[model samples]
Target: MIAFLKGRLVEKTPTDIIIECNGVGYQVHISLHSYSLIKDSESILVYTYLQIKEDAHTLYGFVEKLERELFKLLISVSGIGGNTARNMLSYVTPKDLMQAIASNDIKTIQSIKGIGLKTAQRVVIDLQEKVQKMYGLEDLSTSVYNTNAEEALSALEVLGFVRKATEKVVKKIVDQQPDATVEQIIKLALKSL
Candidate 1:
């Protein structure tokens, strides 16, 4: 099994990138999030999974081993496949994905493209315990990074911020921020509270 390939990126398509390693150009299919991380970088290391069939072989690449493992886990469900799994990974960050699964937030998982009630239910049924164990989310995430806008807003309300103030603060921060981090959230919450 090829664990990963460290190579120079030679070409990138909408869905795949070619990495030149040891005088070989390896084509790797990547997710939108991975593509954002790659951004045409020459030197890149991609953890990989090679799928072979009677007619052809395909290689899928991930930014990290955990992502590769998550992809495989998604495909292992009875009705889920590689494409659906990749699509799920493309839009949602792994942390959010794990949080949703561990919290039994089926609506969040079902919102992903190509995932329906059946697939979402299967995901919750098949992998809920595993994700909870892996992420230590038995308490449903106390990690600093776990707070999204909605969660942070709720916390601020309990901390004496008015409902209107909380909503305004969350809205202002979320509107201007491209990325959500715990520090940023706390700072914003403190400002409002």
Candidate 2:
């Protein structure tokens, strides 16, 4: 079990990275969240999960241990695989994913590119209890109204902006100002986009 890797970063992209440990170079698949965290570093320590298959062995890396743990939990579901789990992490932060699973937010899970309604439901049903147990549902009650964010995202999409890119920008804006209005978010997102 290659638990983690600490070495000089040889190469990096949105989906993967190459790290030189000793004299060996390891290609590690990573999600966007991890990439954003470790992209600027020349040297990094990434927590990894090794997936073994009949044809290949792959290493998935995470910037945080909790994200790696969430990836493991995601892949443990019946219809989820390594790529799908990685996509889920790429689409949303680990904390948001945990919250979605705990709150049974099938819509959010289904919004990820490769996931469908049934798979999203399965993910929620299979992991809801575990997620609630692992990360107690304490903050579930304080739901922030994200209608402004949703409206801003919709407006951006209607104006021909890609949802994926617009989402990142809108999320950043919302994170920085949780109580921002729809127009404020859209204006801010427009500037960033």
Candidate 3:
């Protein structure tokens, strides 16, 4: 349960990095995306997940919580090992992965080196609702829509509608109109609520 390592990076590679925290060097496995982001920095705070097995203990690190969350979700799917999950994170961005799973684009997920057709399909089926719940995605095409949608959701929550139900309605409205303003979204959400 090593939540994170915040220290100087002593060694780095595409696959892993050694971070020195409080005079101790800890080797942590990482995805390519994390490597690229931390390669140029002197110090880093790597979010970590420690996996314990009968034979060995391993630590996987990510530069962002989004990446780490995706890693955990990927590993939770049937037939996806830690290595396979890491490989998937290395091969695809978290945003793209969520989009692919939500849109049921099995081909995009299967494009990863080790992910096969069945695993990809299973990932979509198992994670699609989880992803949607975690992200409350409507139209991921722009950050603006997401922000407005979230603001409207908060407003709806303040208005006493259950957060989950309001989120569902607001996300549906957002999906139908990506350019909806916060007020417009709240108004439309009120009607739906």
Candidate 4:
């Protein structure tokens, strides 16, 4: 396996890039996230996955090791091909993807282009446990009602507060008071946010 490539970037586009290492130019397919990360750099080290098929060998590159791991996990699903996995990574950040899988959020997975209902369900059913175990995510099925925090975060977002920032405040409030109602959570988060 070509674990990574450290080279000068010769050409780049939203979907792919060519990197020159030791006078050899290697064409690598990339997701938009990786492209955005490496776009401004002349030199870079990209973690890569080399996919070997009967007909062709393809190289997919990632800017982060986490992204590469996610790509490998996605492609492991029966119906998910490299292109579909790439599209998924392009459509959502690795963190969001992991959360979606961990939470059994099939709708979020299905929202990606080219992913259908059955495929999304399969992705969730097949990877949910793995993702939860690997990432140490709480199983939402048995976990406490997190709707309060979610609702508070949504309300804050509608009020022009950033979701990421609001999430922290709402989470703190919810942790302090798990039985807090959505209204109460929102009110408390409003003060902190």
TM-score to native of every candidate shown: 0.70, 0.72, 0.72, 0.76
**lDDT string, candidate 4, 82-110, tens digits:** 99999999999998899889877788899
Candidate with more favorable, higher TM-score: 2 or 4: 4
Mark the regions of model 1 whose C-alpha exceeds 4 Å error after superposition: 143-193
**Worst-scoring 10-residue span by lDDT in model 4:** 139-148
Residue-level lDDT tens digits of model 2 in 1-193: 9999999999999999999999899999999999989966778899999999999999999999999999999999997999999999999999999988986778889999989999999998899888888876632322232577778888999999999898778766776787888899989888898
Ranking by lDDT: 2, 3, 4, 1
lDDT of 3 by residue, 69-114 (tens): 9889989998888899999988998888998887677888999998
Error of 4 at 29 (Å): 0.5
What is each predicted model's overall lDDT from 0 to 1?
A: 0.77, 0.88, 0.87, 0.86
**Local accuracy of candidate 1 as per-residue lDDT tens digits, 53-123:** 68778788998777888888888889876677878888787777877887677888999988889989999
Query: Which residue runs of candidate 2 sit more than 4 Å off their true CA positions?
Result: 142-193
Highest TM-score against the true fold, candidate: 4
In TM-score terms, candidate 3 sits at 0.72
In terms of lDDT, model 2 sits at 0.88
Q: Please give the TM-score that candidate 2 achieves against the real structure.
A: 0.72
Q: Once all C-alphas are superposed, what RMSD does model 2 give against the true structure?
A: 9.5
Candidate 4: residue pairs that collide: none
Q: Say which candidate scores most in lDDT.
A: 2
